[model samples]
Target: MYRISVDSSRCQGHARCMAFAPEAFDFDDEGYAFVPDGMAETAELSESIRRAEANCPERAVKIEEA
Candidate 1:
């Protein structure tokens, strides 16, 4: 499995992460991106997660093995 998170401090609300992986991320009231608690990771989702990480202009998306 993988643990995904976003660095709110670094996120600029560009939403590129959401664009790439909407199923893996959600937005706060202020528009910062967050990974919802206990999201399931599938092989397809992992691929999208990598794209989201790569596309983040602020480099806010984080992925770690769980």
Candidate 2:
């Protein structure tokens, strides 16, 4: 398993992450990408998730082994 996170401090809400994997991310009214509280399986390690990580022009995505 993997633990995935978005550094809100670094994210500029370009929405690329959501474009790559909408299933794994949510946007605030202000349009910040974050892992919602109580999110069940958004961290599942998959190609799409990795694509989202790479898609972030801000490079805000973080992934680590869980």
Q: List TM-scores for all candidates, in order.
A: 0.85, 0.83
Candidate 1 residue-wise lDDT, 34-65, digit = tens: 88886644433468789999999888888777
| Pairs of residues at least 3 apart in sequence or in different chains that clash in candidate 1 | none
How many residue pairs clash (N, CA or C atoms closer than 3 angstroms) in each of the candidate models, in the order given? Answer: 0, 0
What's the distance in Å from true for residue 50, model 2? 0.5
**TM-score of model 2 (CA atoms):** 0.83
Model 2 steric clash pairs: none
TM-score of candidate 1 on Cα atoms, chains taken together? 0.85
Model 2 regions more than 4 Å off: 38-44
45, model 2: CA deviation in Å? Answer: 1.1
Residue by residue across 20-51, what tens digits does model 2's lDDT show? 88878898899899866654244457787889
